[model samples]
Target chain A: MVAPVFDSGSFRDPDGHVFFYENEIYRTLTTDAVHRMERLLKLSFVKKSIIEGRIIDTKILEATKIFPKDFLVTEYVLWHEKIPYVTYPFEWTFSMLKDAAYLMLDLLSGLLENNFILKDGTAWNICFYNGKPCFYDILSIDTYVEGQPWEGFSQFLQEFLYPLMIQSYQGIDFQPLWRSTLAGIPAKLCYKSLSRSSLFKKGVFKYVYLQEKLSSNKTISEATLKHEFTHNAFSKKALTNLIKNLRLCLETLTVKSDQSVWKNYDSKNSYEEQDVKEKEKFVVEGLKALNPLSVMDLGCNTGRYSLIAADIAPVISCDLDPTCVDQIYLKKNSKILPVVLNLMTPTSSMGWHLNERKDIFTRVKSDSFMALALMHHLCISHNVPLSHFILLLRSIASKGIVEWVDKSDPMVQFLLRNRKDIFKEYTWENFQHLIREHFHIEKTLPLNNGVRQIMLLSEKKN
Target chain B: MNVLMYCLPLMATSTPCCAYLDAGSSSMLLQLLFGGVAGGLVFLKIYFRRLVSFFKAKK
Candidate 1:
């Protein structure tokens, strides 16, 4: 039998590590964690949370079955239900991150009521399943100690509150920054980046200005520091108020992007009513025929086709425009996972030793892909070669539906207006030839508008 | 005086305080103080409104 491979991302917590055996995910608990797990399992809230889908379901496994009996060092092992698609904070839209923050706060509030608290707050610990954020780390909760401050409070600020505040105030998207940093934007940096007028905002004075001042002050004596942690008593009422205030602050943060090209994409397009109906009919029929387990909709602006595809299978809808992704997320489609991703520069491996997080394509590859109205943007706008684009599609999915817009199309002409028309080979004939080299063309259909064509392709066998 | 003398040597000899409290402990301490006062005020506001409603009902 092959040895169980430990997950690269599960090494941070010393109490436990997740491993995969026979394609099944399992977590092995240290002796210390076994005791904590035993105590937590007896709690009614833990059981209720699992039932309500607020927490991932876990079943304890016999340690001897997982590890060689002589090699076993822990008393217990746990197996968890694998989420269909794991998404990172950097790929989430503003609304998705906001919802995740709310879920964390809600979980924290409930845990505190039951005399328990989270060990730390990291956005990575939460995953979206069934269109709602669910807390997955069973080991994160521990019994609350009297007079102990909320241990996760500061981390919550850096990982969740600060990023949201910066986006709401500065109108600068923080997804790229989060992707690069992985630890989240620091509170000090966020405070410095905000405008002077923004400091006067309702929660800014308390949460940002004061937090920055307190964190930077290094003159306090050791005695004072010890006193702060050991002597400070938090009444239950005060903790309740803290959670409520944080929720209210997050509730008021609303950022509506003003760059609305993709938000109004369907309306602004030159397609006639009959053209849209024909295109939709073709896509729906093609997807029904494929009947894939999961579909990845690349450049899914406003998720028009993604919503239609979700009825047959779960869909991962991705687009470069934050507003477009945010609109899809707000629609609350349970089967659709909407994310903000620029394909030209997708997220890469980052963190310790550059291997803590996997690259975008490695993390999410589907059996079927939909690249609707996305070819010209890559070939003309980004200068990606036609053959290279087809190769990437083949590498990411077994089957795909790709739309080809000939240079004669008005949209392609618009992309060429100011730029030099150097793409002389960007024609329908060349595109078909390049695509056929890697795929077997199964079907072809042209919309009512004669300038565009769609093709269904299956990867060629070796 | 004896207790102070005994404590002075221990304080001087001890290592520089770098006891590894995670990065956000200081902010969390400040929040505890602020949240206590805010929570008290909220509780008072709720009861005060209820008192006004009771008198209006009596009238």
Candidate 2:
């Protein structure tokens, strides 16, 4: 069964609800969504954008049966590839956000050329896949009539432009803004909160003041309507100029936060030079043995081991700390997807009525996984049984490089210094015995440091 | 190069004309040229700052 993970901020539709299923995700379209989907598919721009890279492929699944309650409609889309881990707009670096904004505008411009328009321009609709951002929501595309005003103009400014501007021009942190509002930071909120300096900057002035003024005072019914009429009266040159000004502002916007933790992880780890070398050699050998196409490193603090594996294959380095993910992501530039994950309570697949976001197990089936200096934390800190730990590891990865820290190790001693070691089952012998029941021990490497031992295990014979 | 590429959409948001030019706004080619130069300078400053520091340390 697909377990539920994140459920907040999901859009409500009459449809059956979107759920993450196995390797592929499905969004059960209700009658209303199905109707909209049908109309959307008819647009030529949709066809062209799909043919190009502007839109992600939306393939209708072949499932004839329906889930219980028949809450879904006649059709549902089986999304083959969802982002490995979902990252909200707030977590993005300024450059990344700017790139996403540009991608949306570029796609919109292409849709306009194809005589179509996007129904919305929220950054959430864009997900980073591979090294580039790709549009995922097919529900957001619709036919554009020439004479109609741009309906999503305000949303475009609020979701994409205003947030970027706030970070870029006013130097205000956008993270709080995103955390507070799910619909995106409101335009009026931005118009009022941003500093006056933001409006006077060389190129930022027109965008900060003019764009906000256009979307403000909806209830007042002031001369803003005439201003909008006059603004719309501009020739294609002027309209295009407006689009260009916003584009320039986005391109120059940069977030300069020196708050990354990974930048100084090497200096902070306190590993003796020789000990560090030994650990690196051990990790590299483990990675080579696994030969993974995709690997997940648990407790990948600052990604020391994850980057070693990333040299071989794409790695999803995850840690309990957000600061670690932020630093690793900035260093790698999205090559390795860094996510804030707690192994104790990993993100489950929860969305629209509890199915949109895929759970940790369903989202990944990595060929190789590494849990270096990690089991002690699970056993002693979290009180997970040795048997449960083996089963969980096997479930996540077919093969793994696991480290078993004996209770006598000083690190474990430090953990037990003040408290009782109720974990009699946390001995090396018990861990090895339990692991053998579920895995074939291929090789074991003992390090000079008495704290950790690495074992490579495969599922061939258990 | 990365910053200019990043900012193109922001520049394009209010001034749609800039959307077409990879450099900047399409309406004012001169301003686009100027923005391009400024952006390239920013990249250069970042790229060489460390290098300059390195040489100073050596000296």
Candidate 3:
């Protein structure tokens, strides 16, 4: 039987509360929702756009008896597989947001042709999958009727277009906007913040200003607010143009950040050319021996080592620095998933319904993991005990190949340059003992640098 | 497409005890696809089993 996967409290729609079932996701539609689905499925363009990859496709499946009493249920079609990693908007680079904006508009246009419209235009619905963008919420499409104003027009402006436009027109970063505001950067705030030059621009003036004006003036009646599930007037043409223009605007959106750190990291590492090559060789050989299909680089900085492992497996390169992750994304191909994650405070499962978002441990379980230059950060910066660190690493990957950087190492000294040395137990002997309890240490190779040592450990598979 | 979702559980390497509660990082898209197909099969199995039992009793 398909079990319940995720049920976000915020996603509790009166029409249908969606949930994942089995490997295929299904939405249990209420009796009223059945008509909406039937209407939406009737459009030929909808099918073509989705199948052609222009629009996010929502497939209708055969009926099932497992639905709630007041609901009619069917298993909706889903993507073949999940992407390697999920990067939140807060973590996204400027270019990534621009790409997402175009995707949302593309989907919206197709939905309009199908006589259906998106219920919401939140930026959170878009995810990068397989080098391209795909919509996460299939149920966002609803049956379109004549004369209704686009419900999510203002949201589309604020969440995606405005922030991107603001970044483009003004030099300010949108990161602060997201960190502070809950329901996207408000239109009034964006309007006020943007320069006077921004208002005169053809795309910005027509789309952002006019839409914001319409949204602010329009108000729902008290009766309609009481019955939230009731449908509104939907103009297919306006929706289509809105989507088309937004997409065109997003395609042209650009951001030139001041500096990217990882771009020049190859020249920055303390190791000599020979030492770097030796370290690379050791990591490549270890990965070849393990033959892992999935890998996680715990403290991957711009993915120099992660790329080596990526040759053998799908690698999720994690780092705390946005600049580093952004550079990796721009340089590397999309197959290598780069996520902005702090090893000390990694992405936790959070939301109104915690199940909506997966925690670091929940989302990734790699066949092999690499934590090179990672031990000192955990033991020194985060104050995580070596034993606890080993156990936490155990949960992330089946096997781990990590480096033990001695306190005397220049990198460790750099981290300790300012702070007091409270890491009394941070010794090679103590680390070996802690790791050996949970893993079988197969090999240890002392680096030519004389400051770092690499250890390969395999879990005792049941 | 619906059938494709059901095959993932069988395809996965290790079936963790926590698989049912939260199947790790399996995408909501994959989870929805796989979950729906798997759920549909179970629903049909019980649904048909009941039908067969009712018919046999009448016979």
Best candidate (score: lDDT): 1
lDDT (CA) for every model shown?
A: 0.78, 0.61, 0.63
lDDT (Cα, tens digit) per residue for candidate 2, span A1-462: 333321334454444345654445566565565666666666676667666655676765644553334333344553434566556565455555667789887777766665556776678787666545668776666666543334455566667777777766666666557645644566557767777666666454444453443223221111112232232332333334445676776777676555454546557543568877877887788778777778888878777777787778888777765555556666744457666666887655544546654565665557778888778778888899989988888888888788878887766776788897798777777787888887888888776465567788877652
Candidate achieving higher TM-score, 1 or 2: 1
| Model 2: lDDT to the true structure | 0.61
DockQ for model 3 equals 0.01
Better of 2 and 3 by DockQ: 2
What is the Cα-based lDDT of residue A222 in candidate 2? 17
**By descending DockQ, how would the candidates be arranged?**
1, 2, 3
After TM-score superposition, what is the CA distance of residue A423 in candidate 3 from its true location, in Å? Answer: 2.7
The full ranking of all candidates by TM-score, starting with the best, is 1, 3, 2
Q: For residues A395-447, could you state the per-residue lDDT of candidate 1 as single tens digits? A: 87888789998888888889999989999889889998998888888899887
Chain B TM, per prediction: 0.40, 0.35, 0.40
| Deviating ranges (above 4 Å) for candidate 3 | A1-6, A31-58, A65-87, A162-182, A188-241, A248-252, A331-334, A353-355, A460-462, B1-59
* Candidate with better lDDT, 2 vs 3: 3
Cα-based TM-score, every candidate = 0.88, 0.61, 0.72
